[model samples]
Target: MISNPAKEREVRPAPPDPALDGLLTLSSAQVLVLASGGCHSGYAGDLCCCLLAAVQGALTASSYAQSHILAPGQALALYQCGEFSIQSVGEGVCMLVQLQGDLPGRLLASRLTDSAAFFPRGGAAVREAVLSLSVLEDEHALVSGTAASSYAYTMLTNLISGPSSEAVIGQGEPLSPLVEAAVGIIQEEFPFLEGLDELAERLEVSKAHLIRTFTKQTGISPGRYITHTRVEYAKLLLRGVDPSITYVAEASGFANANYFAKVFRRETGMSPSEYMEITPRKEPPKRDPFLW
Candidate 1:
């Protein structure tokens, strides 16, 4: 049986959504998470720049009568000078960083011919950096405002001017149809997935071939990917009010609570209860008016 740890710490309230008009006045960078199907919009003349990067799943960004689809590891920058909206494509998790002043301008001055630009390729470093920021935010580790700002600035600067070489597959590389289908299934039906053999069967490939191709292309094995997807889903559930560990375990595809705790600890270095102590309780879901 799992021990309840939600009672140990005072749950922090969710941060208020930042006002689009007030973004220009921010003294430090602000990170916002866009859940699946959620939408965020800003009007023209907001006087701030934002970097939107897809962490999981995908995103659709629209502005100036243009729309672009952003797969994981892809990013785009918006100057907020014209009306724009970002919507998650499915079970997407995206990170949006709002910066004050001309920080983004200085960082991307050399690369960005237009203020609003899509970086469909070569954003792997940027994606990794933003993902780190997301982890920091979720773990409540950014207690020092200055430290957070410094980290955000460094990430933005590196994104535009850093070395372009990538160790794994290039972020711009298009996914193969087989791999893409596998990823979509993992994201949408992680809880129901039996194993890599099952995935391989569905994809009409041998298990060994599936492992080789998935790891070669995505830098991770299919088994590990499924584990990651399930863990992420469990994290989301834990952030809600008074979640039960057993339920989370079952819902996240773990066969039993004990196994879930073991895997969760192996991946995160903390038990579910300990994680709950640090993560802020999320507010109830609501629909945004700007979704398209």
Candidate 2:
């Protein structure tokens, strides 16, 4: 978003590399920018907040690759620092929206669209957005154009924020072609996979292509993104326990419950049910602007 989409990703190359540059944006504290990778993939990150308080570097993996976000200065920190490399977090992609710092934390304040979902992973959830300075008022103005175009554009923003009373602004340039296509596949085809190869087929994209596009746009691999989504839903089930494990397993795209249990433990550091015990089971409540 900081640069034009057609402009190449200034970060690292496709394979493991010591110099990977990843980028995202934050316009104002009231406007938020979220970086997300694939859903449950071990290395792919889920949506994470832009440091709202301090004006300094919000988060970083290493010194060399750091984001200097102020209204715009930015950089990418890669983990391939030494000879040994850890799978980079957010190596895939992240999203930026103008937000209302006026609202505390991740309170989805209001939505700019109704028919679209906020996440590419799936579900029809309403989410708030921060519009770009060019797009009209930062917090006002509806997403326009064709239904599909608006939906897709809004979906991109929503994927970063998800369904909630959020604060987002979609006034940046259009997405990279690769990112646009990759997110499209993620939203439209992820629900029908039997395995990695099968999922790749649905997009008419190769395994490598899927991974690269997703990583570039969202900062993680497609497989990992899929994993992140399934696991997140699994977490809800494990915590809420409203749906049985078997049901969660299926809904989360796990072909077998036992397999789901093993992976869930690895990703979350606990079995599904076990995670619910220590982590607690409730969404972070919405902020009361009145209290502050």
Best by lDDT: 1
Cα-lDDT of candidate 1? 0.60
Worst 10 residues of 1 by lDDT: 4-13
Residue lDDT tens for model 2, 1-292: 0122111111111221111111122222122222332121111122222221111112222222332221111212112122111122332222222211222122322321211112222232111122122222322332222211222223233344433211111234455765555444443233345555765676577878767765665556667766665676455445431236665676556877898899898887888777767854432122342244
Off by over 4 Å in 2: 1-175, 279-292
94, model 1: CA deviation in Å?
A: 1.7
lDDT of each: 0.60, 0.35
Worst 10 residues of 2 by lDDT: 4-13
Clashing pairs in 1: none
TM-score of 2: 0.38
Candidate 1: which stretches are off by over 4 Å?
Answer: 1-38, 43-47, 121-142, 162-175, 180-206, 212-292
lDDT of 1 by residue, 55-105 (tens): 556789888756778876567877654788888777565556665544455
